[model samples]
Each structure stands twice: as structure tokens, then as C-alpha cells.
Target: MDMQTINTFLSTTAIELLIKVGAAIIFWIVGRWLIGKVVTLMQAAMNRNQVDPTLTKYLGSIVAIALNITLVLGILGYFGIQTTSFAAMLAGAGVAIGAAWSGMLGNFAAGAFMLVLRPFKVGDFVSVGGITGTVTELGLFATTLLTPDNVYTLVGNGKVFGDTIQNYSHMPVRRVERTAQLAGSVDPLDAIVRLKAAIAQIPNVATSPAPEVNLLDFKLEGPVISVRPYTHTDHYWQVYFDTNEAIARVGKEAGWPAPASTQIHRVTQA
Candidate 1:
């Protein structure tokens, strides 16, 4: 070919290439901005509607990912690429991915079950997956737990859903049990009465059922008084400690008499 023809060909090729790249760049930027706006708007709506936070976050991520994929395909189409065929190819790849990560997919399935079954929620104390803690975040694949000592644990949904789930915060009321010990020499009935009185005075202790104080087991040192108190779930720890303290104080006021039997010898016997 002659120089003139070659120059014309080069010029046309450069312009076409530049246009494709510029179009791709513009689409990429605009698409990203739109994704952000959509996610932000959806987040606000979810918060306003009181959607479960975990589900809301997971749904927003899925939407953003789907939109971004669409944007990429559109950009590819501008470059004379066959996105329809590409999508079919992706479906085949997806099957391979599912096969490779079957366990992960199982976790995903379990997570879906948790969402539908509603066994627990954020802030609920639960025991699952051989661990116990407060549910902090529920995700599509795993659940986050915050233990009593401030430790964070991530347990797979598959394991969590497969095992027994103990939700301590499920009930409105709970029982708190403690024991007050008195020397066996003291009258059991009197100790029981005073211990029950002390538990009743504690704030938030349930009154309808009343506190039950009974003579239970006997130890070498003293007689055991079982103190069972009822209270709201939220006040469980508070009531537990308060009732214990009360029992100790009441027993002390009556005197901590030594157990019935003891041995003593006189040095002057000889």
C-alpha cells in the first residue's frame, strides 16, 4: 500500500480505539457513582423501615454487585464483545465454582434458613456451634458472636444451624438460684424465713411467684438453704448477685456459729 493510504488507515484506527477507551472510562466512573448512590439510598430506606441489619447489609451488597456486573457487560458490548455469549460462559463457570465451594454454599443455605426460621437476633445471647455469646452480626455465610469477655467469634452458619441453638434471652423471665449456709445448730426454719425476706427486698425481684427458700443439703460446716428467686431476664445478673449478698448478710447477722461437732484436748491432762 502507498503512504497516503497507510496514513488514512492509521488515523481511523487511532480514533476508533480512543473512542472505545474513552467510552469505557466514562461508563466505569458513572456506573460506580450510581452504584454508591443506590446503595446509600437503599441503606437509608432499610434503616427507616426497621429491616434486620444483617439482611439489609447483605441485600445491599448483592444489589451493588449485580449492578456492577451489568455495567461491565454494557461496557464490553461497546467494544463489539458478545455479552450474551459471555453471560452463558459465566453460568458454566458458576457451576464449577459451586462445585468447588460446596461447603461454603451449604453455609449460605444455612444462613438463609436462619433468616427464615428466626431462631435468634442481634443482642440475643445464644449458644451454637459449640460456642456461646451474644449475636452481634448475622451474615450470609457466617454469624458473629461477642463473648462475655469481649472476644469476637465468627462461626459458620452451617455449623450454627446444624447444632442445638440455646437462646438465653428468648424468655421474659428467668430464675436465679443461690444458697445461704448456716451452722447446723441454727434453726433451719428461722434461717429460711430470714433468707426469703432478704431476697424479697431486692429490687426487680418477681413477687407473684415469690422467692422460695428451703432446707436443702447438709455439709460438714453448715446446713444449706436453697434460695430461688425469679426476675426479668434483663436483671438476671443483678438479681443473682444481690440475692447472694443478701443471703450472706442475713446469715452473718444471725452469727456464723461453728458446726455442731468439734474436738478439743486439754494440755494439763497429765
Candidate 2:
């Protein structure tokens, strides 16, 4: 071809490429804005219906991801790229990734199941997968917990769902199990009465079941007094510590000697 004709051809090709690139940019921006709007609307609707915030956020994330993927595919199609082949490639990659990240996929599946089962919600105090803490977030692949010691922990949802889950906040009240040792000379009946009165006076103790102060067992040093107080999960630690102090206070006021084991040695001449 002559140089003039070659130059014209090159100019047209470059212009077309530029226009397509510009259009793709605009499409991406618009697509992203629309996805955000859709997610916001869906979340608002869920909130209006009083859906759980954890579920609302989770669903929103899923929907946003799906829409973003669709948008990317659409953009690829606009550039005259065969989306069918691209989708096939994506499917193959997904399979490979799924195989390699089986545990992550399991966690994702468990998270979905947990959302349906509603075992525990965010902010619930629970012991799951051998970790005890308050749930901070129920995520796509993991559950975030804020422990009693102020540590944030992430536990795989698969592990959490597979193991025993104890929801301390499920019931209205939880029982704090504590035992006190009394001097062998101390009266068991008197101790029980004293403990019951002290535990009842502790703040946040439940009134319905009342505090249970009873003879648990006999130790070598003293009689064991079971001092169990029922309280809301929120106030559990407070009530627990207070109950211990109350036990000590009662012992001090009663002037009961600290329990000590006495062993006798028999000396024999053979």
C-alpha cells in the first residue's frame, strides 16, 4: 500500500481504539455506581424489615461481589472479547482455586449455614471452636471474636460450625459456678445460709432462680460450699468476682479459720 493510504488506516484504527477505551472507562464508573446503589437499596430494605445487621451486611457483600463480576464480564464483552470463553476460563480457575482452598470454601459454606441457623449473632457471648469470646463480626469465611482479655480473634467458620457452640447469652441468665472451702470445724448449714445471703446481696444477681448456696462435698481441709449465682451474661464477670469477695467477707466476719489438712503420723516399733 502507498504511504498515504497506510497513514489513513493507522489514524482510523487509533481513533477507534481511543473511543472504545474512553467508553469502557465510562461504563466501568457507571457500573460501579449502580452496584453501590443497588447494594444500598437492598440493605435499606432489609433494615426496614428489621433484619439482623450481620445478615444484612453479609448479603450486601455477596450481592456487590456478584454485580461487580457481572460488570467486568459486560465490559469485556463490549470490547468484542468472547465472554463465553472468558467465563469458561473463570470456571476452570474457580475449580482450581476451590481445590487448592478447600478449607476456605468449607468456611464459606459453614458461614452461609450459620446465617441460616442463627446459632449466635454479633455481640453474643459464646464459646465456639474452643474459643470463648463475644462475637464481633460474622464474616464470609470467618467469625471475629473479641475475647475477655481484649484480644480480637478470627476463627474459621468451618471449625466454629463443626464444634460445640455454647451461647452464654442465649438464655436470660447464666449460672456462675463457685465453691468455697470452710474450716472442718465450721458448721456446713451455717455456711450455706451465710453464703446464700451474701450472694443474694451481690449486684446483678438473678432473683427468679435465686442464688444456690448448698453443701457440695467434703474436702480433707473443710466442707465445700457450692455458691452459684445466676446473672445476665453482661454482668457475669462482675457478679462472679463479687461473689468470691462475698464468700471471703462472710468467712472473715464469722471468724472462721482457714481450712487446713491435718495428717497424723503413727510411730511404731517393730
Q: List the global CA lDDT of all models.
A: 0.86, 0.93
Model 1 lDDT vs. the true structure?
Answer: 0.86
- Predicted candidate 2 versus true structure: per-residue lDDT over 81-111, tens digit per residue: 9899988998999999999999998998998
Best by lDDT: 2
Please estimate how well model 2 matches the true structure, expressed as its whole-model Cα lDDT: 0.93
For candidate 2, give the lDDT of residue 38: 100
List candidate 1 segments past 4 Å from native. Answer: 11-14, 108-122, 136-140, 149-151, 178-192, 214-226, 241-270
For model 1, residues 70-148, the per-residue Cα lDDT tens digits are 9999999999998999899888988999999999999988997787678998889889999888899888799999987
